[model samples]
Target: MTTFEILNGAGADGDQLAGSLNDALCTAAPMVERISGMPLPSHVTVRLLDVAASQALSVVHLGLVYGMAAERLDTEEAFDLAGKLAATAGSRFRMFERITWPLQLGKILYGPTGPELVVVPAAHRAARTSTRQQTVVMGHELTHLAQLELWPDMLTAGPRLRIKAKLTGQPTKSLPVIAPLFEGHAQFVHRDLAAELCGVRARRRLPGEAAPTLRYRATDWLGAVPPLSMVRAIYDRGEKFVSAVMDAGGRSLVHGLFTDEGSLPLLPELLKPELWLARHHPVPAHNAHDQ
Candidate 1:
């Protein structure tokens, strides 16, 4: 059985809020496993961040964290590669004008110490408070926790090594390929759980909801990628890709992609919705959203 610890930073009502979140997690965990075909971690931590803390961390993430890590490269080759990436990122950042920190409801992050799921209370409170929303968000973050647990390397060496290799202009083996699959599969699980528990389709026809026509350019700097639109595209497009896979081959296929890198779909293949539908029989439960 998995256990969760909540580190609430909201001051007043923090404990009470943590309790609510804990209950939400408890209720959602089984559904997450059922939908994702993955097990939850034996132990997990959830952190609650108020708006100010969320903003401050976002600053650190974009500026000092990535930038300083880039500066610590031992080799001249790595330094030069980091510089080039920084230049490209800087130009993109300028055009976007501080798009790095969008108002997010929650995020799963790993630090030097360990991995934790962080949620913005202000943002979550602003949304319509419903059992469905709570279940979906909890299910989503829990799916991330499960991914990190299953791929312990992703938590331990994968991120730092991936960054260093990219900074040194070396080959990045799986992070870029694995990332969308990770998020897409999480999104699939979240939606599936939402449908089962809440009796509603999680997909929404919001702005920027259109599927991608072309594949995203492969880059090691996905973490530092500046375009908010492009970032949104990655999640949106990735979710659709996971949905197609689930529709075609069910949860097991999506789970296989996570557990085995070789089973993962290529970026171009994910971009083509028509191909997925033509080849694989769609899952009836998953296809209910269209009707």
Candidate 2:
């Protein structure tokens, strides 16, 4: 079950928009589970935030990442030191990018019960985006919730990697692979959910339109000795590689990784998933028990 809290900013249309969001999420939530082959929280509280709350949450997220709040501090001196360094990096160096992140559509909220999902419906209204678009945003955040539930460490990969860079004085070679895997899987899942929402909304087959293809260079994604600094730019690369992996081995490859970490792609295998596929699913077969 999902309960919603609207924290201002819908104006008179608040009730109508809230109704649309509830319906959309009810339909969309299961799609996330089906695609990722993972379970979502039994109950998730969804918050619809206005700009002020959205921006405030962004700062909180950063604070949590960096251990700016004392209770979140770890025992490890290295972890805590790196977190302090991360906080400094964000506040001092990445101000503009930091400013932009809070303006996003939705995010996974960390709460006492579990990870909740939050959206800025007013962001949708201000841009005149459709319910389907807003639903897709919900799906994207929903994927993150699945990630948080199933592989919480994956969500922490970014901050940890930055800390590694701070420690080693160089970016790890795996930067290209890890960052993309984190985001790409969610991007692919949410878009698939978007298409389903569209079909459900229309109650008919989607109209044939030539969807524009997105092209990305392996170099751009793979990067030439990726610097820790390119963290923002390389995340977009994940969807293509994830799509390719799904094409090669299907959702079984995704499902396998959760239970059998051995199947998780080697850092080098991330960009070339076939290498991982050839190793893990070369037989190209799975039974009911596989999932």
Candidate 3:
């Protein structure tokens, strides 16, 4: 059994929206578990934030948390970083403004307390709050919940790697491999859940379509290196890798890869999505009801 608490932010409609989102999350949990081969926690907290709150969180996360991590700054240094961020927030407001809208509808964050999913309901108003879209977004965030519970290391790999580099004087490794695996796995689970629950089929990309050019500043931290476009590649390439894995071995194979940390493929192996598909030999489609 699963449960949720909605932290409504400063409005009456937030409660209703949070309730609806809670229902979507409940509906998505079992299917997400089935597809990802990881069980979700019995309880989850969903926070509904309006545009202002959402933008604030993004600024703090991107400017403060990410900046501190990337530079490995000390407390004194953090104040300087905070000052720099505050100074630029005015000019960069337009650039960072998208966080309040559809570009960032939901986020799954884990801290000392536990895991929480934060979403901006106002972000989805442009789409008139389509149930299918909401379901898909919920499913995506829920997959992150599953990852945090099951493979917490994957989510924190960046900071761990950075610390390792600082301590050992070794070169810091970018999340080229890790981010894709995490984001890709979430993307796959999202699509799988959508198919199972909403009868939506996975969208296939045309040749060359998977790697479109994306814009991002060099200084921006997007949970990985090369900022935005590379981050997008992580999703695009990751989905392809996950799809191939699922086609070849079904959910069991995915479960094996996810659970066995040591056996995870390296960057070279991950780069060749075609090889994985060829090796796995596509299996028949799964009947969602069977799970």
State each model's CA lDDT, in order: 0.61, 0.60, 0.63
Could you give the candidate ranking by lDDT, starting with the highest?
Answer: 3, 1, 2
Query: In candidate 2, what are the lDDT values of residues 52-77, reduced to their tens digit?
Result: 66556655666565552223334476
Candidate 3 structure, TM-score to reference:
0.68
Mind giving the per-residue lDDT tens digits that candidate 1 earns over 221-270?
Answer: 33345544566567778888888777677766666655654454545567
Worst 10 contiguous positions by lDDT, candidate 2 = 211-220
Return the TM-score for candidate 2, rounded to 2 decimals.
0.69
Clashing pairs in 2: none
Off by over 4 Å in 1: 13-16, 58-103, 155-176, 203-229, 262-264, 273-291
Q: 1 or 2, which is superior by TM-score?
A: 2
Error of 3 at 261 (Å): 4.0
* Candidate 3 local lDDT, residue 47: 74
Candidate 3 Cα misplacement greater than 4 A, ranges: 10-13, 58-100, 166-169, 172-176, 202-230, 274-291
